[model samples]
Target: MDLRHLLAHEVAAGIIATGIEGAYDSVSCSTAGNYPSMGVSQWEGGRGDNLLSWIDGGRKFIGRTYSDIVNSGELDELRAALDSEQGRAAQLEILAADCLDYVDALMPYLNDSKCVIYAAMWCPTSTNVVRVFVRNRKSWGYDVNNLSALADVFADEYYKAAAVGAMYRQGYSNRAYNTYNYLVTHEIAWELLDA
Candidate 1:
């Protein structure tokens, strides 16, 4: 894989982390749903367990459900574990790996740097949605090879989805729009792949 590709993934993930996770040490429980979520990507449930396990070989938060931790007032302990230097490093490593995996999955359908970054940003929440969008671009009257058009279409579709209360509230439209604007303003395409 291109080093630039990895950098693109990192940059996209950082943007998403800033919006959603707040900080690497941030943690939330049953805010969106019934499960505990933590770290940059907000890994939940089993994924949350996996993150904790990675931090200390499962010594801190393993074999405990969300309720178990909450009822026992262990959430602060969980936060402390995640706030450690080792925990921060684990979060970055896992997030990077996940982003790289998303990029690889998106490559066969969309190779544009902007589109790939957008897809990566969206994939963590709705993988099938983004994948289907890319796969069905042609049937949707979009030229799959037109990178710029594809990027616009992806952002527009994301905006519509956000408005529909499917993934997020209407306010989430700002995320899609702002993400696209950030990419364009930064000229990330030229900076990353020279496209």
Candidate 2:
């Protein structure tokens, strides 16, 4: 039950179905995640500091906390920020940039990335060594057939924060194929089948 092997198998099926060339580079024996991004390797509790920033809108958004909006029924400075034209514009700008990056990551697969990567969860992390899958994404015309199988399998582990899990990757774009999401799905599907 090699997890990476299973991932490559299914992804091969997906690639064949899509008729695309190289959809991925290395199925490294590693995995990573990002909030609203990668899958939880472990059952992380309560979001904590990671979620705290998300609530405060430090990343793509800012302004109010779940409590402030859900319970207090009041908009904070950040929420108020979105209430204006500029704030909405800013958010859109950030989203647009993300989309651009995302598309760049998927450039290898092009139009059919969805069928292979799956639109529901294919999010590619930046072009770096994410946990294990060493992403060499810049190759313009990668024939996935030429790619070799991984020597080991990798997936995110989960438990309470008290438990262990792989550190997630950073920086993302909102382009065509989200490599992160695809990896998560690949990892999960392989784990379940292997289990």
Candidate 3:
């Protein structure tokens, strides 16, 4: 991957790791509706199963349920596996692929790296929502090049959608706002671009 894409992946991964796993090695069987989730981004369901297969040969917990693994003390084993260097690398690799896909999606609407990262961060949880916001903004002739303005539009769109019951969570707007502010405060996008 290019440096910009790599940096975007790293930033998004760190933010997602902080929000979900809090650590690279953390594993949770209950967070995602009792599905075994592992690593930084909580790769769960089919992704979680794929992660397990990649890291642990898929023999331990492929078809097994969460309760079976937990009762068999295999969850601890999974945690230990996730803590390994190979496991962390695998998780990051998968996360980077995911982040890059989001970046690609936003590139058509918002070319600014910061704005793209902000929207890409939401893709993990709300792909359709971010896509709609990007499409709407593009259709309205909004200036997507300005990160702050784009963020404001996103926040406004989020709230308006929530108000009309189009969106389920009011707090989700904060993610876009906070992501934009964080990028600006840290100059993350500029730094990446410079690199």
Query: How many steric clashes between backbone atoms does each model show?
Result: 0, 24, 0
Alpha carbon lDDT of each predicted model: 0.65, 0.29, 0.69
lDDT of 2 by residue, 47-77 (tens): 2223224333433322233343334443244
- Whichever of 1 and 3 has more lDDT, that candidate is 3
Candidate 1: lDDT over CA atoms? 0.65
Q: Which lDDT tens digits does candidate 1 get at residues 36-142?
A: 77767788777787888888733567656667778888878888888788887887777777777677767777656666676666677666666776777756778
CA shift of 25, model 3, Å: 3.8
TM values, all candidates:
0.73, 0.28, 0.76
Worst 10 residues of 3 by lDDT: 161-170
Candidate 1 regions with alpha-carbon error over 4 angstroms: 1-8, 30-35, 143-155, 159-169, 184-195
Off by over 4 Å in 2: 1-75, 83-85, 109-111, 115-195
| Alpha-carbon RMSD to native, per candidate | 3.9, 15.6, 3.5
Which candidate leads in lDDT? 3
